[model samples]
Target: MSDVSTPDPRQSRLFTASELLGYLVLAAVIFIVLPSVLDAFRLNLFGKYLSYAFVAIGLVLCWGVGGILSLGQGVFFGLGGYCMAMFLKLEASTPENTSIQSTPGIPDFMDWNQLTELPWWWVPFNSLTFTVVAIVVVPVILAFIIGFAMFTRRVGGVYFAIITQAIAAIATILIIGQQGFTGGVNGITDLRTLMGWDIRPDSAKTALYFVNGVLLFAVLFVAHMILKSKAGRLMIAIRDREDRVRFSGYNVANFKIFVFCAGAAFAAIGGAMFTLQVGFISPTLVGIVPSIYMVIFCAVGGRLSLLGAVYGALLVNWAQTTFSESFPELWLLAMGALFIAVVMAFPLGLAGLYDDYLKRHIDRLLAPVDRMMMRRAARKTSPKAPAPTAQAAE
Candidate 1:
């Protein structure tokens, strides 16, 4: 037998000690440091930004790993937001609260639009259970249909991206045009409570922020697992050479469909959380522009790194907020210039920067820690020294 030992497949699926440390650092920042440093209001704002991290992470899986670019992630995000919004709107639209309106039990926007009775479809959302299910299922189903129709026919590349953008435009138009049903241009707003919990207060908002952070880490774990598995390997292979994967008897379209649906599911969860954090869902969030913004988030973070995508969302949004406040008239121009500069200077993004320069130094610093861990693992796996035989005991 060869002297070299075979690597552990199960161990290979887990993150390395260095990678685990990175995750722990992020968790500390989110759960401990940020909450301690920032007040509730700023923390709430960060919660909103973290919501966008969901979409960015999805883009990493779809566009980065799978090589399936989708510009309509906003559609999935919006759908989730709307689902949650619809449920919240129903909860807030108590007949006693809306006694002033002609329709005493319906949403204010519906009342304004002369909807006498709740729409048939809106009735199901009255149940929170259904709303939660729909948030993930609805977007995934739509993604499945689209992925099936497009991938089966081999429709991809720039063409696939443009089609997704068009879908976003259509979704936005539909939401706005159906004002009575969807809250129209203003979108759903003035959400106050969830399951009888008043979420508008500072204390409540802080709680929600922690919840968002926990959920984000959960997503990161899932994404990391997917990326470390055989499926992840196949995705990378397909991204590099789809024809070769197909020729090898793999169902390329099915893999594409799965990843696309997964991306949509992730975006949808983000949308739902966004509605909870921000108190609204708008047509503006479901349009082509927002979809493009999501892609930019992934690209800026290093499309391949899940943790990088989260940081990208937080940093980019922070800059946008700062610029918009300081230079309201020129913020958009500044953002455009910033993006151009980043792309020109660092083609691979923040993660790429770390890999190229920082990783080696960091690894060197952690070498001792790594060695200790390896020693422990070897001790656990190595055979105990053979017990001295009875005859040899002397």
Candidate 2:
């Protein structure tokens, strides 16, 4: 047999030292290189992309690992976004600020819609603390209810997806139909400032972009921890063999519920941050179509890899923005083609591509260097050889 030793199993771990080093490199790029290189507008766009990365990472946990695909993730995202939007609108609608409107202390759209008084539900958003709480809590509560109802009943597969899709549709309809209450068909717009600070400035955008980057890394760390825990293994078990997992005396439904709720919360936070950075949230982002597209982000990223998800969301969204601005109609066609290719050709997405085909080749390339180092170490540790053989020959 060849003398080359086998690869260490530890190297394949989800968060191996080398894997962590990769994250560190990526973090450096996000926190250092990109900010230094890109202008304010480009940086702001990247910040928006990072917000989408949150959703994609959450999807990896829920759909990729737990095998619970939710098409209504946008509902949670929109809820969180609207919560933040409500708070910003309230700030912008102060008595002195909106004196020109019929209702001096209501959102511009509300005043335009001829509302003389603030809506009851909009009251809580007046407090930033409550709005922040609601951003996370609302999505978790809704996800818990839906998850409990369906998972316990053993409702899953495509049926669960359809139900989620229905929820997204209903939410979009409610928002569009209730013009006065829900910002109507236009959705929430004309957002400005946060706690008296102007959000329109480039400096503010840069700060928010860094904030987005930090939160994204935080999410990645949490996700990596989850995947490294026992619960993460159980999630995988439940995904691949649900009946077996149930037979193993585990409450598969509860596990599913936990992951699903976690996923919703992540998506919600992303939505709230999106509002903060982009300054608006509309039905366009929270509708079924958009939610479906979000799935494509996860699918393209390699749903099994958190880092892949981030990269996938950024690449796809960047491409979408670039192509849409330039080609418009052709962008849609290209995106559709990409979605299909991901499903059929690259089933495991970019992550799998790296792990399966590329990784082994990379290892092969490095093996000779590793062997050379090993030989050098062995020689050093071994005793020194005897002196020159000329004396022995004599």
Query: Could you say which candidate leads in TM-score?
Result: 1
RMSD of each candidate? Answer: 4.9, 9.1
Name the runs in model 2 displaced over 4 angstroms.
1-14, 361-394
Alpha-carbon TM-score of each model against the true structure: 0.92, 0.88
Model 1 vs truth, CA RMSD: 4.9
* Least accurate 10 contiguous residues by lDDT in model 1: 1-10
Deviation of model 1 at 116, angstroms: 1.2
Tell me the whole-model lDDT of each prediction, alpha carbons only.
Answer: 0.89, 0.86
* Superposition error at 130 for model 2 (Å): 1.1
**Tens-place lDDT digits, model 1, residues 1-394:** 1111433323342656678788999999899998999998899999999999999999999998998999999999999999999999999999999999998999999999999999999999999999999999999999999999999999999999999999999999999999999999999999989999998899998999988899899889888988988899999999999999999999999999999998999999999999999999999999999998888888888888898899899998888887888889997787677678768998667988988998888888887776566555443443442454632453
Output the number of the lDDT-best candidate: 1
Please state the error at residue 112 of candidate 1 in Å.
Answer: 1.0
Q: Please identify model 1 stretches exceeding 4 Å from their true place.
A: 1-11, 371-394
